[model samples]
Target: MDSFVYSVNATVPIFLVMILGGVIKKLNIIDDNFVNKANKYVFIVALPAMLFKDIAQSNVKKDFDISFVLFCMIVTTICFVAIWLLSELFMKDDTMKGSFIQGSFRSSAAILGLAFVQNMYSNTGMAPLMIVAAVPLYNIYSVIVLTFKAKKRNEDGSLIEVSNAENIKKACINIIKNPIIIAIFFGLWFSVLNIKFPVIIDKTITSVASTATPIALIVIGAGFEGRKAIKKIKPTIIGSVIKLILQAGIFLPIAIWMGFRNQELVSILIMLASPSTVSCYIMAKSMNNDEVLASSIIVLTTLFSSVTLTVWIFVLRMGGFI
Candidate 1:
């Protein structure tokens, strides 16, 4: 119980940041145009720098928990499939279907994954390896989803075209161009060859990289608007169920199979089950797919994570992960 209170208290700062974003949007103090600038600041500089710093400074996960990695792959595969099937009922329009499905299956790695890991583990033993292991998985998953949902033109001259293979191709190209994935590749190469960062370079990188979450969180806050979510209620509800329920349900058993238990496994599992990334709303919108629905789902799922995160933490502490 005390743990729950403390954990929830830690989450308050994140919510406050989100509220600040909402307030900014409401006040129109931060023009919509600036949001793009903020994106550039966070994505191109702060985020990539942070990844480089973390990778350079940290000891690599020499032997990734293959089981954990496997779980991540399998569960995400299942999520994409599940969302595709679900889209048939509620989102037959190919463009909307692609974005909606990807949104359902994807997650906000920055906010939920990195921030939550930093908070839960603090100076714990497992965090470094978890971060490294999670990096490739998250990066790959994100690119794949985004590519699949990218704009396509149908034969009938409709603005949206949907093809599983097309999305896969886009994802492959995206992964190649992605800075994070590139960083991960470098990190992995350095790890395999046993490289270490020089003290000065490490310090410099760490200083720049450290800005990622704090600044990104603020930007997320600065961009959020409740108005964007009005018509997206249905997809939001549908996505919440898939994310908080189905994804978690499958992941728990996989954690047990991986031989992790208690708090550690709980942390990983809850993260796996977290709501899809808030960034997806923005990305889907940028690609001109069901932006309203995507944004709504992000808002709703983020709200529900308050409940799901607490429950998962309790269960993990109780040793239910195994």
Candidate 2:
């Protein structure tokens, strides 16, 4: 019951904020223009700032776990590659392939990982290490898949075919120039070098970082198309199941067999099972993928995570795993 309540408390307010965005959009307080600008702001500025702040502040050396980090990276790689390959083989709609693959595998590790672990352990535990390992790969894989699978349209809305070489070039450039990726690089640099910012600069970055999630969630809500989401509901549900259950179902037992328990196991669970991050929608919209599908997956996953996460936690506790 306590875990259920905690899960609800942690997740419900996020969707509530999204709902508020939808309500405000209906009320004419914010429009498509607002949504577009908010998405860009969160993508280029706020989200990167948040990533930088989180990664930079962590004592990477103090909490270093090479084996655990390698496990996270390997699991993340397997999930991303397997999902992308499966989506390519089975999904016919190129427009949705990127969104489905991304929405299916990417967890909100950076945002929810620490919170969930801290809730259980009264400290950050291995969550930060998980973020350090998994979050960068999350963004990198997203950029790669979204770039390669992005649709190119002519002025008449006809599809344009580019060469594989072109896509390779574009993916490389996008990965190099992605704001979030760049932020992660600098954050790692700062953490490794033990760099400290002045109080004023730190506060300014903190302020900007704080706006990332809320504004991103609002943009998702305001931009959501209900009819469009309903049309994409099948993929949305599938994506949610993959995010909130399937990945964890497969990887978690392996983690247990490898001797991860308590905080380490809990952090792994968040990496494998947390809701698809709201940034999936932002990146999808910005990259010209199916934003509608991306948003629907996020909405469904977030709504269902309250129950799914609670169940996972309960099972873990019952088994004396955490």
lDDT per residue as tens, model 2, 120-237: 8898888878988998899889998998889899999999998889988998898898999899889988988899999999999999999999999999889889998998888898
Give the Cα error of residue 260 in candidate 2, in Å.
1.0
Runs with alpha carbons beyond 4 Å of true place in candidate 1 = 108-135, 152-169, 192-194, 319-322
- The superposed Cα distance between candidate 1 and the true structure at residue 226, in angstroms, equals 2.3
Per-residue lDDT for 34-121 in model 1, tens only? 7777666666576667666555545555545666555556665666666676677667555566556766777664345545655655
Q: Judge candidate 1 against the unseen true structure and give its global Cα lDDT, from 0 to 1.
A: 0.63
Error in Å for residue 302 of model 2: 0.2
lDDT of each: 0.63, 0.92
